[model samples]
Target: MANQQVNRDFLFRRLHSLLGVVPITLFLFIHLTMNAFATKGADAFNAKAQTLESMPFLPVIEWVFIFLPLLYHGIYGMYVAYTSGYNGSKYSWGRNVMFTLQRVSGVVTFIFILYHLWTAKVLPDGPSFDMVQQILSNPLQYAFMIIGTVCAVFHLANGLWGFLIHWGVTVGPRAQRVSAYVLMLLFVVLSGVGVSALVAFHG
Candidate 1:
């Protein structure tokens, strides 16, 4: 019975990790890419946003593919963070620090997402170039966005690295190291894109 319980727990953890990489990560990439249109102009951004809003059953797609997975992953992650002890101080290793950051950022990103959804989606006005520009007009709001972007990007990129390791995809030391560099590059690019979109709104 104990063994069976352990197996179930392991399976749940694996699923949580897998979900981060699949629809969750894929959606983030798509979202950032779509928002990147803002850099071109408001018309470009609005057109992209309209394209998304025009999708049939958009709410259903969001709930199934994005929101549900995010909720599960965030809740489970918070549980893990609360239950787990931080050993980064003792280990003083990069991965150890990253593990700690992963937990911290997960919580921050979760809150950011909730607030963002409320402001952008829940309101009857809906998200638009003007709406985004207005929200980002406040300096504090701009700062919060920059911070949120960093947290979300780090969470996804580092989560990807953890996902690969946990799944035994890159177990060897050399392979793991290479994967680390690639993931770091991915983080930089994603952050750059996200921040640029936000900046475009600011200007």
Candidate 2:
């Protein structure tokens, strides 16, 4: 029974790590790229939005490729976070702090994604550049966007490194250290693009 439970835990952890890197991360990349179009001008953003909207079975694609996987990954991640203990205080290591921050960011990013989708996708106004600008006109909404973007970027970036470690892709300390730095650079670039697009709304 103990062996079975251990195997089950291992399986779930593997699934959680795999899902985070695959469809979930891919969706985030596409999403941030689309939002970065805002930096090109609202017309460009609107054009890209309309083009995406015009895709056949796009809602089905979203449900199958984005929403369902994201929901599973998020829920399982929350469970893992709940089960894990935060030892950053005791360990006082950079990786220990990042481990705690990754879980914290996961929770925040999950909530942010839910509210973001509800407002931008499920609302009667639909998802348009003008709609986003109008919604972001309020200072509170703007602040939320910034917080959400940063949390998401951090979560995904750090999660990428964790995924590699969990999957045994990066075992040695040197490999892990190099990957960590690369992923941090990735987070900065991704967040910079996202924040630039967010600020473009002020125009």
Candidate 3:
């Protein structure tokens, strides 16, 4: 009975840990796709953004759906990494590289997201489509945006790889080896599409 209880508790904890990733991953995919619309024109991007904002109880929904999930996922992911004896140097080269990339990119994405929200979503006198055009027209904004997009893509891909492992799909030596290359390739393609969209918007 004790052993069964322990197993149940362990399973619950793992599920709780995983719950953090799901909503955030979904939101990231949707957000990346929507932001891609910016490539078309300011009007297109604004229309999408405004439509989202105009939804009933949008402010409340944003807090529930976006902010809360992100906070939990980011914080819980870091906690899991810390507790799981995750050592970058001990893993295979590809695994180590991806692990490091994910950590660094996660931090970068968090910072960029915070800044984006502050400037684009929260501020009282924040910029409009014209202002965004002017800002993004600057070389600095362009560079920062490119870096942020790359970081976001890498983070998402890396998280997906980790999720697979957690769900028992990629176990042991051979599976880990294969997953690394696959995830890396996927990240490259995803980031390429994202960056292209941003560039097209600016052009």
Candidate 3 — which residues are off by over 4 angstroms?
A: 1-20, 77-92, 124-128, 172-178
Encode model 3's per-residue lDDT on 1-203: one tens digit a residue. Answer: 89999997577557544654666667766776777777778888778877766689976877888897777656655554456544676676766766777777877887787776775667645334565556568898778888988887888777777777878988887887788779789889878777876676677
Write down the TM-score for model 1.
0.96
Give the best candidate by lDDT: 1
> Please, what are the lDDT tens digits per residue for candidate 2 over residues 40-102?
998899899889989999889988999888999999988988998998999998989998999
Per-prediction TM-score to the true structure, in the order listed: 0.96, 0.95, 0.76
Q: Show where candidate 1 strays beyond 4 Å.
A: none
Ranking the candidates on TM-score from highest down gives 1, 2, 3
Q: List the residue pairs that clash in candidate 3.
A: none
Candidate 1, 98-186: lDDT as tens digits:
98999999999999998888877787476689999998999998999989988999999999998989989999999888988999899
Where's the lowest-lDDT run of ten residues in candidate 2? 120-129
**Model 1 local distance difference test score:** 0.91
